[model samples]
Target: MSDVGDRNGGNDLVRFEGVTKRFDVAKPALDAITGAVRGGEITGLVGPDGAGKTTLIRLMTGLMLPESGTVQVLGFDTRKDPAAIQAGIGYMPQRFGLYEDLSVQENLDLYADLRGLPRHERAATFDELLAFTDLKRFTSRLAGKLSGGMKQKLGLACALLKKPKLLLLDEPGVGVDPISRRDLWKMVENLTEEGIGVVWSTAYLEEAEACDRVFLLSEGKLLFSGEPKDLTARAAGRVFRVSGIPGRRRQMLTKLLDEDGVVDGVIQGDAIRLVTVKDRETRFSAAGDAEVTAAEPRFEDAFIDMLGGGPGGRSRLAETQRSFTVEGEKPVIEARALTKRFGDFTAADNITFDIPRGQIFGLLGPNGAGKSTTFKMLCGLLKPTNGEGRIAGFDLRRDTAEARNRLGYMAQKFSLYGDLSVSQNLQFFAGVYGLHGAHKRERVDLMTSIFDFRSRQSMSAKVLPLGLKQRLALACAVMHEPEVLFLDEPTSGVDPITRREFWTHINGLVEKGVTVLVTTHFMDEAEYCDRISLIYRGRSIALGSPDELKARVANAENPDPTMEDAFIALIQASEEERMAA
Candidate 1:
C-alpha cells in the first residue's frame, strides 16, 4: 500500500504504462498493468500459476509486445527501443536458455559475444560472472551434464556477462536447493548495491521476502504491492505452531483449520502452524498438545490465505506420514549394497533401500547425490557393478523384462515427443506399453481427464506450458497403469498451483494402490510423499516420514530446523564422516 520509491535517488529504471499483453483465446496476460522499477533495488513478482509473471518479464525484456499499453526498460520504450533494451538488460526465463550441447564456458562465451562484449573484455567478464555465480570450477563441463543447480548458476552467469543496468529473472529459484537459493539471493543483493535494478519473478512465496518490494499478482491483476514484512505483519501474532503426537496433531489442526475462527494451517514437519484472525492464540489448544508458539506467517501461508483454501488441504497434510503397508508380501523392490561406477567415479556406492507395494516413496537429496543412478538401477535401465536387487518380486539383474514390465518411469526431462500433440503422444506411449485399440483409447481418455489434459489435446507437447507439459508426461507415463510408477523430479520448474494440482493427481493414484517412487530436489514436495528416503553421496542415509527424518538429524542447537536444513545438515555430517574415514 505504501510506495517507497527509489532509495538511490535515481530516475525510475523501468516503468510500465498500463501494460497489456493478449493472446487469441485466453484473457490478457497483463491486464493494463502499470508498475515502476526503481534503480538500486530488488522487486519481486509473486503469483500463482498462469498469473502473468512470466508474461510481465517477457514484456519488460522486449521478448513480446504489449497489445495496448507500453513497457519501458531503462527509460526506453519496449516496442520502439527494443534493440537498446536488448543490449542493456539481462533476462533469464523459467527455462534457462542454455545450449545443452555446448560446454558451460562456451555457453557463457556465446552469450557474452551475443551481448557484444569485446574480445579482451570477454575474458574478464566471463571470469567475473563465473565467480559471481560460483560455477568457475565447472566451466568446461557440458551444460547438459551439469546438475539442475549448476545449470541454474550457469544461466545466471550467462545473463550477467555484460553487466546490464536492469536484470529480469523469471522463477530463478525454482527447483534449486535452499542453500543455492540463498546464495542466489545474496548475489541479487550485491547487484542492487551496484545500482542495478532487478525485477525477479518466483512462485515460492518465501523468496519474495528478500526483495525490497513485492507485487502480488492473481489472474493478471495486481493484488498487493508493498514490503513483504509489512504485508505479513498485518497477520502477525495471528499464526502459531503446534507440535505433538501425530494423530492428535492432525485432529486439532483439521478442526481448527476447518472451523470458523481459523484462517489457515500449514503442516511444517512435526508441527501444525495455524493462522487465525481472532488474535487469541490460546483458544484452540487441547490437552496433550505442545504449546502453540507465536510465529510469523510464511510466504506460503500468506499466498494460501490469499487464495482461500484449495481442495485436499487437510487430507494432503494428513498424508505426510503415509507409509507403505503390504499385506502378506515382501517389499516389491529392493537394492542391496548397490555400487555403480563410471570410469573411476562411483555414482552409487553401497546404497540400499526397499519399496513396498502401493507406497509413495521419495528420494531426497542435493544435486550429484547419486539419486539418478539409484533410480536407473531400480527401473532396470542400468545394471549395478556390484550387489543385487529385485523389482516386483523379479530379479533386477536377471529378469530385466519382468521387472521393467511392472515398472513405468518418467525421466527428469519428460521423454515425450514434443513435436506431437498430447493425444498423439499418449497414443504412441499407450501402444509402446502394449495397450491397443479400444483399451488404449480408454486409458488415454481417462488420463486426459485425470490430469485435466482435455483443453490441450491438440497442442504440441512443445507448445504446451510448463504445467501442461507435466500433465502430458504424467499421462504418458501411466498409459499402461503399471504397478509401480517411478517419477524423477516430476514437479521441477513448475508453479505452486500447478505443483499442487500435480500432487493432487499423485495423491489420487496413491489412493488406487499404485506404488510411486519419486525423486525430487524440492523439500516441500518431499513432505507430500507417503514416506521419504533421503539419499546423499550414494547411500540411503535417512529414510522415514519427513518429520522423522528431520528429527533424526535434529540439531538441538537449531531445534526448529526445517526439512531443508535437516537435509543439508544430514549431508554435511555424512560428508564429514566420509572425509574423516
Candidate 2:
C-alpha cells in the first residue's frame, strides 16, 4: 500500500532498502523487503514463527549484515558502520542476558557504565527508570529473583539508559501473562510519545492493533502493510458470531468447519466466531439449533482472512475411535486443600479444584502466581506440604505410582529428545508406559499417523519446525491413552493456525472421556475450557465457566467482554479488594 514503499534515501529513523539476508543454502530470510520507521511513531512487524522477524530485528541492530541492499539506522549505514548504528539504537532480544547473581540496581549500573553515562546523569536516569518500571522497591533483590514481568521491565530500563534514538523489541511478551503484556505495551507507548521510534515484532495479532502502522509478513514476504484500521477494513461484513446449545458445541463446530463457504470457526466467550471467504452473504446450515448474527471484525479476524483462511492441515484422528460417556457422578480428578511451601515461603496456599470426566479445565494467572506450583502438586511430581489430590480415583499421597498410571503430562517446554528421530522418541515413551510387542507397534503407528508425522518419522526432532515440534510433543504425551491429560502452556510460541489445530485434537479427546487440565497465557484459548479457575498469589480468586467469568466483569461500558478484558478486570478487582482488606 501507500504506507510502505521506496523511501528514496529519506532521513527516516530507520529504513530498509530492498534488504535481503540468508543463512547458508536456505532461501533468503528477508527477500527484497523495504520499509521505514519515523522518529515519533510505533511500527509493528507481525508474522508467524520463522517468518524472519528475528532476522529483520538483528539486521537493524547491526548484528548481521544485509547481503545485497542497505539498512540505515539513525543516518548511519549498517554495513559500513555497524558500531555507529548500534550506538544509537536499543535492542531487547527475546532471550536477553541478565546475570542471575546480580541485583537489579547492579545490572542497571553495569549497563550505564557500559554506555559511558556520567555519574551526575546516571542518578537521574536510574531514578526515572526504576520509577517507570516499578522496580524501585526491589532494587536490592537479585535479578534472578524477579518475576518474568519484572525481568522484562528491567531489560527495558537498561536498554533506555543511553537515551536510545530508536528501540527494537523482538517478541517481548511471547509467554507473558495479559497483565504484564499490558504494562509492557503502555511503556512502549510512553517511549513513542517522547519522540523515540519503535519497531516491534510479535506473533500475537491482537498486539498489532496498538501500532500506528503494521506490516504483515509470511514466509519472508510482506502480504499487507498499512494502518491497523485500514487492514481490518478488508474483512468488513465478512465475520459472524454463531451461538448454539451448550452441550452440542462440539457437533456444531464440526459442521461449521465442514461447510463450503466457511473460512474458520473458533469458540469465543459463549459463541463461535465464524469467518467467511469474502464480504458477501453465504450459507451455513447448523447441524442443530444455532443462531448466526453479523458481528464486528477484529484485527485477528482480518489477519486470518487476509492470509487466506488458515494453515490447512489434515485431521488424522482414528476413524474407529468410540464415543466415551462419563461412567459415574463423582469427578474424575480432585485436589483438596493443596498447599506447597519452600521453607517459610508458601508458593501455593490452600488451593482446591475439581474436573469432571470429559471436561476441559483451565488454570489462569500472572507469572510467579503459583500456577506451576499447583500443577506440580496435582501431577504428583512434588509433595504437597499439606492436603492431598486424586487422579482416576487413586490417592495422590498414599498411592502415587497408581495415580501416575492413569494420567499423562506434557510440560511447557515440550521436553522432547532433540537429537533422536521422531519415531525413536515415540518408541521410548511407549516403553516407559509399559507398552510392548504388538501393542507398542500398534500404538506407535497410530500416533504417527494421527499427528501426520509418518513421512518425517526418521527426521531428528530438533530439525523440525516449531509447529511440528508442538504436534510431536502432544502426540508423544497421549501415546498411553490415559484418562487424564495435563497440558501446561501448550500453545506458547506457536502461531494461531497451529494453535487451532492443536485445540481441535484436544477437543476430540474430550469427546473420548479424557479429562484435561490446561494453563495458558492466551486468554482466547481459555474460552475453549468448559470451566476456568482464576489463580493469583497462591490462591483461587474465582471459579466459573467462561461466560460466567465474563459476566462477572461485564457492565454498561463493556457489556460483552472479550476474555482478555474479563481477565484484567477481575484481576484488578481482586487486587483492589485485597488492598482494602
Candidate 3:
C-alpha cells in the first residue's frame, strides 16, 4: 500500500489515488480524484469557488482525510504520517493568519519561534524575508495597520520561515492590488527556481496561465490537466471580435447568442466579443451594423468553451428597456475637496473629482490608499471632515438619505444576509428600494430569470457559488434601477468568464445612460472604464481615460504600455514627487 502511493516517485511531490471526500448530505468534495503534483514546478488547481479546490489542498496537507483511496505527501501517507507531512510542507491556507497586534518584526519573530528555527538562523532568515517582501522600512508598524497587499506579503514571509519543500498558496491574489499580485507571482517563480514545489489554487484563470501545469476542476472532477497552451488550443480559431455596433446593443447581444454555432457573445467597448463552436460553420451579422473578425483564443475562452458555453438565455439582470434619466446638465456625481480624517491620520485627503452622467468611471488605487474612504464619502456612508460631495444634485451632508436613494451601492465585501435564501434576499432588497405590489413581483421575476437564480433561489445565499452570489448582490443593488451605481472591487475573486459577463451587463447599463462609479484591482478590467481617477495616499493623483493614462506613462522602452504598466509608473512617479516635496 505504501509503495502503491509511490507510483511517480521520481518527480511527483504529491499524489492522490482515487481519493474521495464528502460532507453530510452533500456531493463529494473530491470525487475519486487521481493526480500528481510535480516537484520544482507550480501546479495550478483552477476552478470556480465550491469546486473543491480548497478540499483538495487540505487533503494534500493532511488537514482532511479522504473516505476512500490514498493521499501521499512527500512519500508519506496523509492518513498515517500527517504530522510528519505537515512538518515538511509549508501550507498557506486561503486565510493566511497574521497577528494584528504585533509589529512587523515581532510578527516575523513569532513565526520564527513557532517554526522552531535555530536561534542562529532566525536573524538571517528574518533579514532575507524582510528584504524580499519589501517590508524593511515597515518593521516597526503594527500588522493591523498594513494594507491588504502588505499583509499578504507578510503572510508569505512567515510561510517561508522554515524553507519547507512545498509551498501551497490558495487564492493569494484575491483583493490584492495588481502590482503586489505581480510581485507575489515573481516571488513564487523565484521559489520554483530554487527547486521548491508550489501548488496554487485560484479562480482567476489569468493567474493559472502563469503556472507550468494546470488542472482545471469543476464540481470536484478533473476536466483538463496539462500545459496551459494545450488548454488554450481547445477553442482555437473560434473566437472573434465584432466592432462598430451602431445601436441596440442588448438586441445585438441577444441576437448573436441566438445565432447558430454562437456559444457566447458579450458587449466590449463599441464591439461585441463572440465565441463560436470550433467545427460549426456560421457567419453572423448583427443588424448589418457590425464587422466580425477572428481573434486568437485565450485560456479563458477555452475554459468557457469547455464548460459547454456561457449562460445563453439568462445572461443579464437589468431590464431590457431600462434607461436611466439624468436629472440636470451637471454630472450626476460631484465631489469637491472631499476629505476624511481619522483623528490626525488622513484616510482620504482633499480628494476632488467629478463623475459625468452615463459614464463608467473607475476609482483606482493601492489598498489602504483610501479608495473605500472616498467611496463612503461619495455614497453618503461617511461624512467628509471638510469637503463636500453631491449625488444627483443632492448634498451628501445635508440630504444623505435622498442622495442614497438616487444611487445603487454594492460594497467590496458581499454584505448580504448569509442565512437568507436568494429569493428572500432579492425580495428584501426590492422592498428596501420601495418596490411593491406588481412592481416588486416584476423586478423579482426579472432578477430570478436574468441571473438564473430561480432554480436555486431557495438555497441560502451563503451556500451559493461565489459567482452566483456576486450576481445576486448586483441584482439586489439594481432592483431599483437608480441613476447611479457605486461598486468597490466588484470583480475581485470572480472567474474570468463571470467577470466578462458582469462587465458586459455593466456596459449595457452605461449605454442606457446609467452612470457608474466603480473600483477594481484588475488592470485589464480598468480598461473597460471610460475615465479613471488614480488615487494615492488618499489623493487623486491622475485622472483620465485608460488610453490617455497609458499614454501619460509610456516611455521609449515601453511604447505601447498596458494599464498596469501605466499605473505602476504613475504611482512610482507620485512617490518620487512626495519624497522630493
Candidate 4:
C-alpha cells in the first residue's frame, strides 16, 4: 500500500456533528448522528438494514449532504468542499461499478485515468496494486469472469489507485465467503499501517468486533459508540452455554428464548448459547437433563442486547402454517449423483444428499464453489448433466412441474418485482403458486399479518429495507406452504436480529414438517442446520452435523473449533489432497 501523504496533526480524520439525512421517507436515514473516524484506525459503521450505515458512509464521501448537521472529511466540510472531499477519499460503494466486459488490466487503467493518475506513474501504481491484491496472474481475465473474491479485490484495487487519505468501504464483504473476508481484512489492516483512515460499514458483527471503534445504528438512531470490547463488556456474565441435549439443541433454544429471564438464545454446536436479562443470571439451573454453564460474551450478544433483544417466541408465520406430510418415509428432498458441466468445466461434480422430512440441510462453500449450481439443479432452474433431483418423491427432470409445485424457493438476491407493492407481489406469488380467489386472499392476508407487512403493504417492494425485502421474499415463497423450502443465503447482509427472526420462522416451519435446503456464507446459520454438505471446487468435502464437523477439525492447539474453522480447515485439506494428486 502506498502512503498517501503526511498524517493529519489531529487524529480525527472525519467528524459528524448532529448529522441528519432524509429521503422521501417519514424517518430520516440518519437522524442527528454524531461520530468520528481517527487516522490509522478502523471505525465500523455497524447497523441492521436501513440503519443509516450506508447513508452515513455516503455523507463521509460527500456524495450526499446531511439535512441538519455537517460532515467533515479530512478537515473539509462536506457541504462546502464536496469536490475536495471526493478528491481526497477512496469510496467503494456496496456495488462497486466495474465494467464487466473489460479485462482486469483495462479496468485498472480506466480507474487510474478517472482518478487522474499521470501516464508515467500509472505503470508502477498498477504493478503495486496488482501485487497487493494478488490479481497479477488474472490481469487478462475479464472483470465479469473473476470470482466473487477476486472481483472484490479488483474493486478495492480500483478504489486504492489514488491512495486517498480516507478509505470508505460499504459492506464490501457481502456475499463473500469467510476466507475471502479474512483476506480483505488483512489487506485493509496492512493499509492502515500507512495511516489511511478506514470507515467500514458492515452487517457482520464479527467484522465490527475487529474495528478499533464502532458506531452502532438502529432505525436512524445512534445506539452506541465506543471500542468493541467495551460494548462486549456490557454482556459479560449474561451469556451461557447450555448443553447435554443431543439432537434437541434447537428445541431447547426455542424454549429458552421464550422463557421469562432469557433475552436471546441460539443453537451453537451441540449446545444452546443463551444471553439472559441483566442481573437475572441465576434464574434457573437445569433445562430438563441439560447443563447450563457461563460462556464468554461475543460482540453479537452485545449487539442483539442493544437491539432490544431478538424477536423472541415462535414464528407467527409458522404458527399459522398447516402441517405437511409425506407417506412411506421417503426423503422429502433428494439429490442423486447431481453433476453440471459447462464446456467441460464441472460446476457440480456428482453431488448427492438426502434431506428427510422436517430436516434443515445446509449447503456451504466459498464463493464460486458450486453450491449454487447444486441448488439451482435441485430447484429445476438448471438442468443437470447427470443426476436426479427429487422433491417430495417427485423427480426434478421427469416430473419437473410436479417437483416445482411441491417446493418453495427463496433466491439469494431479492427476486420480487421491484415496481410492485408488497401486497401486489404477495398476491402475484399466491396466484403463481396456484391459489385462487378466496384462498389467495386468505393466504395473502395471513402473510401480511404473520410477517408484519400490513403497515408497508402499499410500499413498492424495491423501497423496503433489506430486512423487510428478505421477509417479503420469504413470505412470497412460503405463502403457498410447500412441502419443501430452498433458501439461498436468505440472511446474507441483514443484521444479527433479523437473522434470528428469519431462523425462528424457519425453525417453526421445520417443526411443522417443512423440509428446508439452504445455502449460506454465515457460519452461525450453518450451525442451525441438522446437517451440512461442505462443497468446494464442485464436490462435497465434508458431510455431517455441525458438532460432528467441528469435532473433525478440533485439536489441542484449538480444541474448541468454530464452524468457520472447520469449514476452512476441511477446504484446505481438500485442496492439499487435490494438489498432491
Candidate 5:
C-alpha cells in the first residue's frame, strides 16, 4: 500500500489524514479529520459540544486509534509508533490527572518517575517545573489541598516534566480565574521559547485569539482553519449593537431578523447586536431605530452565527418576559452573617446576602474565594459554623429537606452515572428528585427537547464530550423546574458556543420567575447575572450590579480600566485596605 504506515517529513509535529473514529453504528465521532500542528507555534482547536475536540486529542496522544486513516505525531505513524508518540508528547486531559491524595511534590515525582527520567535528574527537573508553575511554596501541601487554579498549574507542571516536544492541553483554563489564566498563558509562551509545539483545545474564543492559528470544528468536521485575525476580518462590517430597555431587545432582534437583509442578531443584556452579510438597510422608528454601525464581532457572536443563528422560538419568547418576580414578593434565599472555619482557615467569614424571588444572583470570585463555601451553605450541604441562612424562606439548619426539595442544584463536576445513557441519567435524577409517572416523563421530554438532548440521548454519559456533560447536568437539575436553581460553575469548561446555548436555556428558566444562585469564576458570564457578590478570602468585598462595580473601580484613579482590570484592581485594593485596617 503506499507506505501508509510511514511518517510524513515536515516541521509539522503532528498530522492526521482521513481520520475517523466510530463509537457505534451511527456517524463516527471524528469524521475524516485532516489537520497538522507545526512546531514552535500554538494551534487551537475550537468547537462546540460533540465536535470531537477530545477525540482528536486522544488520537494524537496515541490514547486511541482511528478506525480508518492515519495519525502522525512527531514524524512517526501514530498507529505503528503509538508507544513512541506517547513517550514524546505531553497530554493533559480536561480532568486533573494528578493523584489527589499525593502531595504536590510527590505528584511531580510520580509523573517524573513514570516518564522514566533518571533518578539523579528528577530533583533538578522537579525544582524547575515547580518554579515555572509558581508552586514552590506549596510543595508539601496535598494536591487536593490546592485551589482549582493551583491544581491546573500543577497538572501542567507535571505534564511538562519530561520536556516533550509536543504538548496537548485540553481546556486548561475552564474554571481558572482571569488572572490565573493570564499566568497560564505566560507559561505556554515560555514553553514556546524552548521550541515546543502546542495543540490546545478550548471553549473560550477570546482565549483562542492568542493562538497562532485556529481550527473551528462543528459536529466532527472542520469548518474553518487559519489565523484569528482572518476570522475577525471576514466578520468586519457585519456587526452592530442596539442598546435599549432589556425587555424590548429580543423583540426588536426577532423583528429585525424577519426583515430582509438582516443576517443575524444577538441579545446582549439591554442591547441587541445584529450581524449582516449584505449592505445595511435602515428602518428608522421613533420608538426604536435600527442603526447600522461598526463593532467587532466576538468569537461567541461569530460562533452562534456560524451554527445557523441565535436561539429562537418559545425560548426566545421566554427571554423577553421579565415576569419572574411576584407582586410584593419575599426573598427566596437569605443569609445572615454566615461564617465557616476549617482549623485556622476561615472559608466563609461573616458572609451575608439576600436573593430576591425570581432573580438570578451571581456569587463570583477567583480560586480560594469563599464562593463555593457560601454555595454549599445555601444548599444545606454544609452547616455554617456561625450565623444563619434560609432557602425558599425555609431555615437551612431546621428545614433542610424542605429547602432542598424546592431547589435544583448542579455541581461543577459531572454528577451523573457514567455508564448510564443520557435518558437513563435524566430519569435517575428525576427519580432522586422524587418525580413519578407522567409528571416525570413529560418534564424529561421537555428538558430533552429544550436542551437538544434527543440526538445524544442514547449515548452513555462517559462518551459525551465536556459540553454535552454540562448540558446533561443542567437538564437533570431543571427537570422539575424548581422555584430556585443553584448552578456552581455551570459553564466552567464548556466551549464558547455551548456556553451561549446554556445561557439561552438559563434565560428561559429565569422568565418563569425561578430564582437562580450561581457561583462562577468566568467574569464574562457574571455580566448576565442581575447582581453579583464578589467574594474573596472568606468575605464579600463588593456587591452590586456589574456596571456599578465597574464604574466604581474605573473611577478609582487607575491608569487604564476595563471590567477585568477593574476587578483585579478592586480586589487588590480590598486586600490593601484590609491590611491597613
Candidate 6:
C-alpha cells in the first residue's frame, strides 16, 4: 500500500470552485458549490434524494461537467482533462453494474480487463481484493446468487481494481444490512489510512456522523460544511426523550408531534425522542404518566432540523382514509407454516406469524434471507409450497383474489408506470383496486390534495423528484384503502424528512385500525412496529417487540442495545447455533 498523496504529489485530491450543474429542471442539480476532498480523509456528501450528492460525485468522476464553475480532480480540470481525472479515480454508482450471469471471479476479472491492468499485476490485485472483500469462498458463485451484502462487497472490489488515488462511493449502503454496512465502512476507512481520498454519499445520517468532514446539501444548496459535531451541536438543548405508557408510545408520539413547540418526534425503543423548536419553551401535556428528560442529539436530529424539521402535524392521508372493519375476531393476517421452495432450494422454511387488526407487524431480514419470499406468499403474489397464508381469515392459496382484494401492496421498487402523470397513475391504481366512476375521481383528487401533488399532478412520474415519486407511490397504494397495507422498503433512499413524513402517514393509518405488514432494512423504522419477526437462512430466528428483541442481546458490557445491534447479534447467534448443531 503506497501513499496515494505521495504518488499524486498533492494532498488535495478533488476541489470544487463555485461549481454549478443543471439538467433542464427548475433548479440546478448542484448550484455554485465549493468543497475539497483531501487525501487520507473521508468527505461525506449528505443530503436527501434530490440534494445533488450524486451530481457532485459525477462531476468528480468527469462523467458530467459543471455548467458554470470548475471541478478539479487530481490537479486535472474535469472540463479540460476528464480522461486524466477519470484515470486517477475509482467510482462506484448506486447500482453497481455487475453481470448477473458471471461468477464473482469472472466479474472481478472483467473489471480488471476494463481497467487495463497488466497480466503480471492481475494475480496480485485479484488476490488482494478477494481477501479484502472476504469473497474468496464465493469466487465460483454467480454474482446474482450472492446476498445483497456480498454483492456490494464484490462491487467495491471491482471499483478498486485500478487502485486509483481517489475513491468515490455513492450510497453504497443503500440496501446493505447493518453488519455489511459496517464492513464496507471498515474497508473505506482502511483506504483512507493509506492516503486515498474518499467521498461517501449516503442518506443515512449515522454514516455521515462518522466522516472526517461533511458537506450537507439540500435542494442543490450547501446547508453546512464542516465536522459532523458542528451540525449536531445545532440541535443540542432542543432534544428530549418522552417515556409514557408501554403500549401507547405511538399514540403519544402522534400527539407530541402536533404540539406547537415540537419540531420532530420518533419512536425510539419504549420512548418518543423529540426535537423542539429552537428558543421555544412550550410545555408538552400529551405524555400522560410519562417522564420527560433531556436527551443527547445525533446527526439525524440536526439534519432534520436543518431541513426545516419534519412534517409535524397529523397525516392528512390518514384523515381521509376509511376505517377498515374486520368481520370476525380472528387474526387480521396469519402465516401458518408457510414455506416456498424452488426445486431443492428453500426460500422460506415454515415461517409462521399472526397479526391482529390495527397493528404494524414488521418482517425483518437481510437480503436473500427469505423474508421477501414469505411476504410475497402472504400477499398472494407467490403460491406457497406448504402451509397457509391468510388475510382477514381468507386463505391466500384458496381465495387468492379475495385475499389480494383485502390488501394494498407497495413494492420495494416504484412499480407505477413512469411515463404516466401523477393523476393517471392514481386513476390506474384506483381502477385496479376496483374503484369506479365518481368514487375513483374523488379518490384521485383526494390523494392529490393529501400528498400535496396539486401543481405536479400532470407532471410525468419519471421526471418527478425522488420524494415526490415516493409520495405518489404511497398515495397509489392506499387509493382503495384496503384493510391491510403492505410497505416494502418504502423509504429506502429518501432523506430523513421524507421518511418522517412517510411514517407519519403510516402511523395515522394504523391509528385508524388499518393493519400493516412492512419489511425494511432500516432498524430504526422497525421501532414503529408493534412486533417484529426476524428471519435468517429461511427460518424465523427471533420474534418480539423492539425492546424485547434488544433485551435478548443485552449484557454487562453493553447494557443498552439498539435495534441494529440486536439484529446483528441475533443473526450471529443463529449462525453459531447452526454450526454447532
Q: What is candidate 2's local distance difference test score? A: 0.84
The residue pairs in collision within model 3 are none
Give the TM-score of each candidate.
0.86, 0.93, 0.89, 0.96, 0.89, 0.96
Quick one: ranking by lDDT, best first?
Answer: 4, 6, 3, 2, 5, 1
Residue-wise C-alpha lDDT for candidate 5, range 280-380, written one tens digit per residue? 65452311644445677766566666666654423632443335557677788898999999988999999888988767798888898889999999999
lDDT of 4 by residue, 152-226 (tens): 999999999999889999998988899999999999999899889999989888899999999999989999999
Please count the clashing residue pairs in each candidate, in the order shown: 0, 0, 0, 0, 2, 0
CA lDDT, candidate 6, residue 291: 89
- Poorly placed runs, candidate 6 (over 4 Å): 1-10, 325-328
Q: Is candidate 1 or candidate 4 better by lDDT?
A: 4
Clashing pairs in 4: none
Arrange candidates, best TM-score first.
4, 6, 2, 3, 5, 1
Can you give the lDDT of residue 283 in candidate 1? 74
Better of 2 and 6 by TM-score: 6
lDDT by residue (1-581, candidate 2, tens digit) is: 11111332443688888988888456878888988887777889887767788888899999899898898888777878889877888988877567779999999999888888889998899999999999999999999888878888998998899888789998788778999999999999999888788988886778888899988887777777789999888778888888855565755676677787778778775688888887456777763567788899888888887767753222455232444565774788898999999998899999888999989999999999998889988899999999989997899999999989888898887699999999999999999888999989998999887788888999999988778998888887888888788999988867787788888788777877788999999988999998999899889898999999999998999998888998899889999999999
Output the lDDT of residue 93, model 5: 93
Error of 1 at 483 (Å): 3.1
Mind giving the per-residue lDDT tens digits that candidate 3 earns over 84-196?
A: 88887887777648889999999989988888889999889989999999999999999988888999999999889999778888888888887788889999999988778
Q: What residue runs in model 3 are displaced by over 4 Å at the alpha carbon?
A: 1-8, 24-26, 244-255, 265-272, 287-291, 313-316, 320-322, 325-328, 419-424, 435-464, 553-560, 576-581
Predict model 1's lDDT versus the native: 0.76
Model 5 scores what on Cα lDDT? 0.79
What's the lDDT for all of these models? 0.76, 0.84, 0.84, 0.89, 0.79, 0.89
Model 2, position 87: C-alpha lDDT score: 81
Model 1 collision count: 0
Locate the minimum summed-lDDT window of 10 residues in model 1.
Answer: 1-10
Q: Comparing candidate 2 with candidate 4, which one achieves the higher lDDT?
A: 4
